[model samples]
Target: MSVSATHAAGPPAGGPPPSGRRNYARSYWLFAAPAAVVVAAVMVFPWLFTLYMSVHDWKVSGATPFVGLANYAKMLSDDRFLWAIIRTLIFTAGAVIAPVILGVWAAVTFAGNFLGRGIARTVFVLPMMATPVAISLVWTMMFHPQLGVLNYLLSLVGLPPFGWVYDTTTVIPTLVMVETWQWTPLVMLIVLGGIASLPQDPYEAAVLDGATPWQRFWHITLPLAWPFVVVAAAIRMIDALKTFDTIYVITLGGPGTASETLNILLYQTAFAYYDLGYGSAMVVVFFVIILVITLLMLGYRQKGIVT
Candidate 1:
């Protein structure tokens, strides 16, 4: 049919001609509307409210007056806030570093064929399956000053029972151990997938050249697995930075803010102390820190993928 004749013909015999634009528009809305509504309800509204609260002096009982950036400025002179930042930094670094190393090792070990390997892998990942609150409750018992199983074990070895969460110095480290034990499996799973998908040619060639397992791992495995490591590291850092449930359930930002991160601080400010404006300010600052860290990690991720 000629193009002009087809156009002039207009509608089809049975029904109106298909309107691609209209159909696409309808489909787009159909697919996107629910997700868009969800985002607006769950994410956008909360964020906007937080921003509004951050600008106003909103107490639990008092009248809310717009105070601009005063709440944010207050963060600078707040020593506890400064301490919270340092604590969070320490926690994040330790959590990310330990898990990535152990996870890489675990991934390599589990990648090998052995008896009951599948069952072992399942057992190893059990910690990752447990809810953070459940894990914290269990660990809190384990960390008891004298009554805990950990202390009992120490007694058998002629060692004193040291306070885990109760002590300020050991609180963060204890938390890190808990965090690492739970999340290491996740990193292992991610890296294991990457390891499984790796090309065998390089390893085979390296073996033919009489390369030892250690040498092969150092030269071939690590370089090939770098991208996956970056991904795992970035994810772990982000998760660790926002750690709240564990801290809340275990110590409640106790041992005198020893283990309090930005998340905990924000919580305390908002709910515990009822300083909504200051809490919102802390939330915004906390988000900025996370955003910056994530951006840097993504930059490294891009470089790793490219190289």
Candidate 2:
């Protein structure tokens, strides 16, 4: 009886089965806990607080009260806010366009084997490496009406000396120039990376077809590098939209508020006027605008990938 029925119940084959998915899930949560907590504390909490504050009337000198879209209504009707939006769009466009065209050209030039290419790249990127405040200060000195180097150079060239930031008409354009100087290196680096990574097959084929260098670039290089161009443009656009430090240091959104972008207006509302509720509303609007732009960029990237 013992022999027949006492065949020892062996353990299940393959040692023990693998741990269940639930166990791995628990392990993942354990690993992610610190990051999740930090994100909740730093980002999610502040965003939620801002949203709550936006729906109320909160002043720096007084208690907050529920205002239920009043701040939004006020912002919508404020002519200055509308102007800020327009200026933001114009500034973004200028900042994105000039830097992209110039940077791509520079990148293409550098991609060629040339003497002193390293030195040239370093010089081009110096503006980007410098602190924005320092750069702005230098620009301010150069833009000085009487003793500035820029006007001095203009005088030498038989052109009239101009007040760059002080003139209402030229303030925004001057800021755009500063921004392009500081940020163009970024676009150049991106484009250079893309160009360097390109397969040589297409270029070789074009050469075999008797295509000139310019024709090869126009037909093969540009299309292949188009994705990187779009990406660089989007990054520049977003940075330009949020530009504050250089603008603040240079013009203070002045020359009669001609250069006040959305960020400047939001700063004025929150810090200058101490209207937290209104400021929060402005921030929310700006956030929505940025989100829409980012989504559009992502859509373009997806299209690039698919095609």
Q: Write the per-residue lDDT of candidate 2 for residues 1-307, one digit (tens) a residue.
A: 4754544553357665346766887899999999999999999999999999999988988789999999999977899999999999998899999999998888889888989999999898888899999999999999999989999999998999997998988988889999999999999999999999999999878888999988987888888999999999999988898899999888889988998989998999899999999999999999999889988997998899898
Q: Candidate 2: which pairs clash? A: none
Model number with the top lDDT: 1
| CA lDDT for candidate 1 | 0.94
Error of 2 at 292 (Å): 0.3
Each model's lDDT comes to: 0.94, 0.91
Give TM-scores for every candidate, taking all chains together and pairing residue i with residue i.
0.92, 0.92
| Predicted candidate 1 versus true structure: per-residue lDDT over 130-186, tens digit per residue | 999999999999998867999999999999888889999899999999999999999
Q: How many clashing residue pairs are found in candidate 2?
A: 0
How far in Å is the alpha carbon of 27 misplaced in model 2? Answer: 2.6
